[model samples]
Target: MFFSSDHPKHEFEESQQCKSRDAICYLCKNKVSLVEDESNAFYCCQGCGSNFHKDCLTVTYPKCHEHTLTFIRRKIPFPCDVCGQEFPDEMYGCLQCDFFVNRHCIYLPRVIKITRHSHRLSHVLRISDGDNVCGICRSLVDVGYGGYSCIDKTCNYVAHFHCIIRFNVWDGKDVEGEEVAASEADDVAPLLLVEDIDGESTWRHFSHDHDLLRVVEEQESEELCQACILPTYKTGKFLRCKECDFALHETCACLPRKMAHGLHVHPVTLHVETGDGFFICSVCNQYSCGLMSYKCNQKDCGFKMDVRCASFVEPFNHTALPHDPFYLGVDFNEYIYRCYGCRQRSRFTARCVQGSIDFDFKCLNLPGLIKYKCDDHPLTLYYDHRGHNSGWCEICEEIIEKGRIIYTCRHCFTTLHVDCILGKYPYLKCGHKIKVNGFEVEIASNNGASRPICQTCHRICQDKHVFNGKDQVCFCSVECIPSQACS
Candidate 1:
């Protein structure tokens, strides 16, 4: 219900001039009662015979307009002018103007903060023309409809009205009138520049204790990056610690201290601490040892995502699979499907909406090219062994399945299993210490005089790596890490 404010005094004067019986209320499009007293009706315009029920003229939506907006009844469904969503229910609008709003969207938050972006989004009647992709769902956002867009004009971020309001996306707060909090001082830099002598900059990364020297030269060494646990051979530029053996890929070193991910509603902070041992990423379900993770900020939530999974964004286009660009489904967790890449059933996957193809994160993020021990040249990842007969893996000595992803050398045509090349814990670096089932375990090389016997699998550790405990108990892979502590 709206009270007549001083601002609409001219409208009230117009209502008083056209006090006529048997006239239609322009606000509600309903007949003014002839039996009712003159005080019950209000005239809208003198000569137009446009009158309004005093009850209809009393209600106003201040956010949408200054004039009175009243309930409108319609038998057919109509698209809301604000959200552009079609609905069959009655709506509220100003009869004089074409502005009609859904009842549910009447009090939409003017300003909101979502987990997938850094900037606050503002509710607007219309975004720009052309293809407007939603930042969350990676679907087309209608430019004619109302949606949330970045407050910064320079940033072209936009989200659908339905996608932005989901429980997993929005925090459900309207911060329009509240005081904006100051930017976090710690978020300014991923690494602090300590000294710049003769164009060589020594920096202190937040993940490391000592100062680091940027090495632009590509390294051929097999040493793994402490941040991502990936070998250094392929990493072009990296930052090596001046004091100790800690090092990080230049890309990994520049990761922001805090970010919002689509996996959870709250912002996640970068965690470099290695005390918790191996953490299984909630998204990829892969074990990561000595690699940094992005953990949810909520106190009770146990959401932790690996760096690889955290880096993935909507509408991902793999260079190898360019024709099938995949986008994360908004309700991916609610359903499971067989993956096209690995044939494993998983809910955490991105889909090629056009092709109806799903690829799990594990198979989706496989390195395109990697060096194998037996092959002199780098092996290229193959989605399917097309144009070639299915062969056995040279490393695993197992028949390479037709549908499964594999790595093959074009020069030698040597085929290898994806797991045989990447191993069970591909992200886990050799020689790093991790905790498993309350036991301190070390990732050890399995290339000894005799392969170690895996305690969990009761077989010889066939993989290139093994997890060893202080008691000499061995595990072939991260999946074989015993639930009970080693005696």
Candidate 2:
């Protein structure tokens, strides 16, 4: 009695009226049998001059076509027109048009913008026959199915429907009708070239106040770059400030003034404010002095990251985890995920593409060999301590857990916890004055006659360094630095 058994109607006159009309059901593509007298079930849209089943109005997908698609509950194998894949399940379809869409493809947005590309991509039903490569995964795209393609005719960029929608790549925003906002030139470029002499360039980077000269020759001095806190001379090429001792590695100097990262959906700006004091990176969760950081200025969203963690891009490869190239996993700041390297929870991690392995930012960038005061020889970062259960950390005196990443001196047989060796604020230089929450604070050594009680937490300052405020209040770690004015 109903238009279709799947679509049940309450009144008999409505079903009779549909049977009487010659107009086809725009949704299921079924013609009304011209025999009945009464009519009330059909819903006519005056604007579009289209007739629809009463139930079909809700399931209408304008992206597919102007006509509605009827919901069907059959398990027959059918190739979905959107994804071009055969699924044995219930779906929405037009029987006459031979068009079907699975549940997953039914709700896909018409347009999306991803961090992988500059242009907004439009969902297309098919690509002109050719061998197309996905820009994100570096794999061949099947042209037979629907996918996302660059809207600009001049650009030939195309990507698989699945590859572009990964959480790491896309922010899941539908920008179908939105106009692209043009950005200022200064926002993307990092430096301005002042002059060039004998293939060397003099430039003024946005992060610094003075002009910098590019130096190519390797030097022996151990001056740390103001940007990354790494040795400037060891990096081979660097930009040295002419007016001051400030220096930056060439790569660090050229970081974008503003950029979008996978960790955050919003754009972040690079800041080189030394007065901001130490900030724990949102991605790596490591304490770093705010000498250079990418900070999100969104109100109430205090997202900040160090340059080292900000520099990581997709398809990340590491020497330690050489089995497969990794992709940015979920930004674990709001969730908990474990890292394989240190066996500790991390705020963010890079997941192996082929397997279930993840590495946090700190463990991902650990130095293989480092000098420790207890051992004359350089301590080596050991992956597994299965063979030797060398009791406790030499510094913290805590039981060294099995399978944890530790620095060990093979000769001296001394094992130390990674945190115990690097301390909490490894990137923050000692003897430097910085402003923490508008309070002038000095990074000072804690190895005095007795450790001072932290003003904020009232705990003994146990770390290698203590932050002394202008009021002579002591704080244990950067985490204890109060965001408000001291009493």
Candidate 3:
């Protein structure tokens, strides 16, 4: 199957490579089945003597230079010239020059369609100009190199190569020759882009009476998203009730309605609001407010799922490692065990417990890279904290626990405790600015300098939580807002 005009005027030959149990494909960077699957045949290029899958032989792509890259076994680790991503597996490369490319880089669709945006996104080779931020990961993208961008020039939407294809946003279909379904359930009515009487895009959510208007611009007053409990920053688009002040980010609005949820036997219905007062989530054991949550409708099922739990894409695959998928398992006061991730012994934590294995949501959701205003360079998450002198945390000054996963700045030798950086309650994102008290107050660390006291309540801002935005900033909890404080 390996054929190329560029290889030789006199046809170059390929000899059949033996059927092995496992062989890595140079193009896709995935191990191919050799024994079980009869189609796992490979051929060696007489021109190159490099082993290649029959499937990978044909993905010959031409790079910026005139070099034509063909699939071949990688003797040395190579970085793709197109995407700048490194790969250890065999890849399409010119045997002569330094030019190399992965299958994804070679055949990456020129245009893609995703659920997050309405317009078709084209694979841009370069940013051309301006700060084009990725809509999904919230990180700055490389403008020098190209990425997925909205087809519409006026639109500012852009996405990094990996961020756009995350399990949260994409359903893993390439935009080539396939019609991308809006969602897994297209039969259900689409609640996202509906319009109200004012000609603004509005949504009729199962929760509220009035249609929720999509607010693009930040209002003079600050608004907290009912779902995530974070301020509706002007930068992010949010849906607000035209009748009332209820608002939530678009990501929260698109949360699925029904899930087996793995933790509960009965299917949980996404409840907009419960007439019942002050329901605590069965898994995280946190109190819920007015935001929509996945609540068990079954009799005596007191299980409630908060928006963060509900928003996690189901069948939580652990592709980062070769392990069984983690289901959202709940203890329900049954099992009290130490978490393998934090090594903390707690009666209960926000954990994803599999049989004989336990990992807290903080461990699962911990970003690979952490940014601290306290330090210049971002700290990378290090799993093995052994042999290093139990360094003191820069924030709390507590000894960094040994054998626990911690964030560390290798350059400066600074280490941080898991909770000191993430928080005791990691689900509630701390330190991000949201509106409180008419000033932009930081969600300072509980262990950091001085904790802010609520001007009205006179109690310390417990957990060192802070939310700030346009009009107001709050040091204490959302309950300690103008409604309670002003009263």
- The regions of model 1 sitting more than 4 angstroms off are 1-77, 89-104, 128-130, 179-186, 216-219, 313-319, 322-338, 345-358, 384-392, 397-403, 448-451, 478-486
lDDT of 3 by residue, 103-166 (tens): 5666666677664565667876676566665655445777766678887888888887756543
The alpha-carbon deviation from the true structure for residue 90 of candidate 1, after best TM-score superposition, in angstroms, is 8.1
The prediction achieving the highest TM-score against the true structure is: 1
Error of 3 at 168 (Å): 27
Candidate 2 per-residue C-alpha lDDT over 1-487 given as tens digits, one digit per residue, 9 for 90 to 100: 2233233431123443343346766555666444433342554433334455555434677777556676654445767777666755346777768777765676688898765566778999887666586766556777877888888778887877766655456767788888764321236578789998898788998777899998865655657778777667646788889999888888888888777676676667888765555667877777666478998856677888889888887777765455577776654235477777678887677777666677888886676667787678878877552334657898988898766677888898898988888776778777777666666678988879998999989989888889987568898876677765554
Compute each candidate's TM-score over C-alphas.
0.75, 0.73, 0.42
Tally clashing residue pairs in candidate 2: 2
Per residue, candidate 1 scores C-alpha lDDT tens digits across 9-37 of: 32333343544655787655777665545
Which candidate wins on lDDT?
1
Q: Return whichever of 1 and 2 wins on TM-score.
A: 1
Worst 10 residues of 1 by lDDT: 1-10
